[model samples]
Target: MPDNSRYSAHIGYLFNELPLESRIAAARAAGFSAIEHPAPYAVPAADMAALLREAGLPYVQFGLRSGDASRGEKGIAIFPDRRDEFRANLAEGLDYAEAVGVRMLHAMAGVLPAAEWRPEHRACYLENLGLAAEEAGKRGIRIIVEAMSPGAVPDYFLPTAASAREAIAEAGHANLGLLLDVFHTVAAGDDPVQAIHDSGETIAHVHIADHPGRHEPGSGRIDFAAVRSALDAIGYAGFIGCEYVPAGVTADGLGWLPRRA
Candidate 1:
């Protein structure tokens, strides 16, 4: 086990071979004080909440309903014609967050064809985000937008933390912020340190995976030490979400987790 005070297990990537309850137990065993997931809509919210309480873990964050990935739809927020779909998903996500005591909701900007980046799309995105932020704010929850790397998700509307910041500003909601994924920043050819420094307090959450392989932090070219230093410089006191794909057993791949005690 390690001193995982600033770490949270993204169960979608860690111990994903197990069910939710088993994943929670594994995260606790591995010394994580909090947990997050991609989607938990399959299980009842009460059941998920009970599992977290039993494991003594707080729910840090979770993503809103991105449309079916198999159909090439990453999310609905920015799709001009999917306003109703986005609203439905937003309601569901907010309900789930309230039920599970999640404090942050990552509202993924949908992937669109390059030709379809029209004014309507942008307007729809900001409008939907504004509404989502207001609704989440009422419950003391924050709504965060993450930038997906274009290399991994081609034509993703949001492709860099800089762009996310601009969008958050346009949305004009105090509860809106950014979720800076270091892997995506590298993939977008942006310096992670600079991104963190520039994003500053707008970064309410973070996700980490190495650039070259999207694996454990130390398994690739990313200089996590430098990244940590930049985060420290910015006075970031949030969890560093472990969202990398494990090379083998998830636990065996956690060599980068600090063993403070």
Candidate 2:
């Protein structure tokens, strides 16, 4: 097992084949101190809270409800016409974060309409994120902005770590920060270590998936040891979320987990 203290099971990907409650138990059994989910809005807050308590696991992170995935809306944060919808989602996200005792909330940036950047869209995103950051600050939750890869989420507005950092800065809120996913960094043809070095303290959370396949850590070309070294170099203390699809059985792919010496 990985050192439960340093790692979090992203149940959304790890035990995705199982039901929610079962996944919670599976994380506990696998020795994870915490777990994250993509969205838990379908589950009642009380029920989700009870399950986490039962497993002695802390809820580390959860994402805001991006608009319809089937309809190709990756997020509403950057959609100028969806300002009201984004506000409603933010309120729901804050409430859910409080109920689940989670400290971080990922605010996904929606896909670009023309597969290119738009000034108005960036403006709308900053406004929406600033509002969410204030609300999140009140609830002791940090708002995370993640950079999506073009291949996985084509036309995504924030497609690079630098862009994410810029958005967070322009939002001008203490609670706004970056969700640095190493897989996305490498997939974008950038060095994951340099992204880590650049992100530094603004990194509120980290996600792990190997490049070329988006599979478990050891199943692809990423050198997680170097990633670990960079994280330590930057004094990052947040949970390292194992957010990868397994090539086979999930449990069978956990050998790359960092066990404490």
Candidate 3:
């Protein structure tokens, strides 16, 4: 039997067939121990919290509002001119997190046009990250940054584990950590096992998806057993979020998941 205790169902990706509120009960019925979503603002926090409580599952992690996703803005944290917007988004995310008992938030580094990229962008990102860490720390929350693959998220500021590590070091906040996603790590040409080893205790959370297709685990080239081993080696005890698109029906694609018996 596969260990289900540490797996979190990312409802944002999985259960797309159902509405957000219904996804909670689906995750519980599907045997997930926890659930996460990138944007649940549409569902009131109190209602979401009540759903979680009724389902007996914890809401683990969610991303800060990426500024106007419809407008192609992945995030605003890396733009010097958008400081106010970033902080407002952070405050809103924190409020929702507190309402739902979540302690981790993914702070996305916004993208920039290739021609407009400048050193000031990095400086701005570091500054915003520091502020986010400080504010989140006040509420006993830890802020995590993940490197999204350029192929998937064009012009993303932080696109590799190395870049994310450099930013974390420069930011120098105890509450700041890394959210290691195996799919992005591999897509960026870095070895996921090595990333897990190098990140060590700085890894606050983990995401899993097979590369090449970004589908369910066994549908692609990633060796999830090795991923699990590396995570174990690093003493990572947090939830491993399933953040992949299903090849078919969500439940049918779950053959890769081990049964509880």
Candidate 4:
């Protein structure tokens, strides 16, 4: 647990594995005041709202499901073949975002192209975002895209800050923005903090964790204190999400953070 009050946890991959309500309970017990994850479309929206209220956690953020990369499916907005599906997903996401008080909706490149970056691929991605931005604007949710771990997702699109910046620029929509991930930055061999600073103006949300293990902030090879310092320097006022696995009990490894914060 981060002792700092400034920290929040993205009940990331874990939320999908547990009973949603139990996950919410775990988040609050771990000292997280806010929680973000994919909406439980499979679980009823009313049940999710009840869980959020009962757990006393007020925050939620999530991206719509992107299919497996192994299947060669690119994000609908990014690949021509998937455009219709992508737009439909966005509509569903917007409805849930509204019902659940989700403030951020990451336009995560759910799946990647089979090859490396392409001008054609980039065009599709930007075009898709342009349409989705209109939907996001109406719902009051920002559609920020995220970069995944480079090696973990090499063929996937949107792995670097530069590419995402370009895509957003071409899209030219205010509602379209960037989501920064520290674990992916380290995986890409870029200074996550510096990237954040350079992309600060365009940044909408930040995902933080230590690497090479993607563990909680203090337990990995990456210097999280430095990352936190860089974020502070950049005047980044967005939530710093604890998106890592715990070495022990999630609360045991994290309880110190809330006290210190």
Highest-scoring model, lDDT: 3
Provide TM-scores for the models: 0.96, 0.95, 0.97, 0.89
The TM-score between candidate 4 and the true structure equals 0.89
| Model 1: residue 64 alpha-carbon error in angstroms | 1.5
Full ranking by lDDT: 3, 1, 2, 4
lDDT, candidate 3, 117-234, per-residue tens: 8899888999999999999999988899999888889889888988888899999999999999999999998899999999999999999999989999988898888889998888
Residue 170 Cα positional deviation in candidate 4, in Å, after optimal superposition: 1.7
- lDDT of the candidates, in the order given: 0.89, 0.87, 0.90, 0.72
Residue 85 CA displacement from its true place in model 3, Å: 0.7
Each model's RMSD to truth, in Å?
1.6, 1.7, 1.2, 2.6
Candidate 1: stretches off by over 4 Å = 1-3
lDDT of 1 at 80: 76
Model 4, residue 245: C-alpha shift (Å): 2.3
lDDT of 4 at 222: 79
Order the candidates by TM-score, highest first: 3, 1, 2, 4
Q: 68-103, model 2: which lDDT tens digit per residue? A: 988998888887888999989989988988988999
Model 3 local distance difference test score: 0.90
Residue 179 local lDDT, model 1: 94
Which window of 10 residues has the lowest lDDT sum in candidate 4?
Answer: 1-10
The whole-model C-alpha lDDT of candidate 4 against the native structure comes to 0.72
Distance from true location, Cα of 46 in model 4, Å = 1.5
